[model samples]
Target: MSTQITTDRLVLRPVEASDAARIADLVNDPRVYRMVARIPANQTVAQTLAWIAGHTAGREENTKHPYAIVENGELVGVTSAHRDSTWLPFEIGYWLSPDRWGNGLMTEATEALVGWLKQRGERGFVSGYLDDNPASGRVLEKLAFMKADRIKVFCLGRGEMVGHVNMARID
Candidate 1:
């Protein structure tokens, strides 16, 4: 079974199949979608379910770990870490409901996720945020992720390559 983690004010649970509709509703918001690299804008419930379907296999293979952010029993966001190659550091990413921004929730959730990974003996991690999204950069900074460099990345929601600020942390 997938692991569930709890924090003082949040619960980090394995993403469930039943969460597809809520996930779709969250990611479909342009405020959330435009900031996340992979999520398409206006995603459908079917698409979100298809994405959630991979979490189990990903967890088993250790290629990806995605968690649903829950506050007061309500699902609010998603955070994950993944690496394309074993030699590469896991790249952490997240998207929260716009209503939850500016509350330091992402920072808290991500810090817990990183701690969990470190407990599993994983150390190095990399993350990036759209250059335009300073709030996300702040979340990484608060977690001791230093600015590594800048690069251009393709954002599915924007339909174009955009400036991205890469950050890294070695626990």
Candidate 2:
């Protein structure tokens, strides 16, 4: 995978076709997706592959960035940011594999992505952590994202509840 940028101990690159299973397994783990509402309770590898393809392809085609975080040559997480078609500020989102928890991989990837986004002269704010996922909130806090507001039950899908928090980095 080509490098988007590398931290001292982690590599961030674009997601590849072969990475779908690894990402799928990790995402399918109950611990990771229990709080995420939009994803299915039992996501098949096929569904994951398709979802990754569509999301990553859309991002790449639009010049929006979505990076797969690699540690020791293994895909362990993801980080991304982009404006929706509505001209909103780029929404920054991320997830780290359960196996990689406590390794600082996600935090490292987030810092790299944020700094990269800023250096590219990107404008608008970056919203962070909208799914009642406090782990994400913690990372965003580390990156200096401030809470804007909260929207209860932003989406109801796949038999899950999705609350949202709006955040911004106007710097």
Separate clash counts for every candidate = 0, 0
Superposed model 1: Cα runs more than 4 Å off: none
lDDT of 2 by residue, 1-171 (tens): 124788999888877778878877877777666645445556778987787677665564444577888888888877876565635567777778887787777888888987877776666656655465787788778888888887765332335345777777778
Pairs that collide in candidate 1 are: none
Q: Which whole-number lDDT from 0 to 100 does residue 88 have in model 2? A: 59
Ten consecutive residues with minimal summed lDDT in candidate 2? 153-162
lDDT of 2 at 45: 83
Give one digit per residue, the lDDT tens place, for model 1 in 19-78: 999999889899988998899988999888888887678787777889999999999999
Using lDDT as the measure, the top candidate is 1
**RMSD values, in order shown:** 1.1, 2.7
With candidate 1 superimposed using the best TM-score fit, by how many Å does residue 156's alpha carbon deviate from the native?
Answer: 0.8
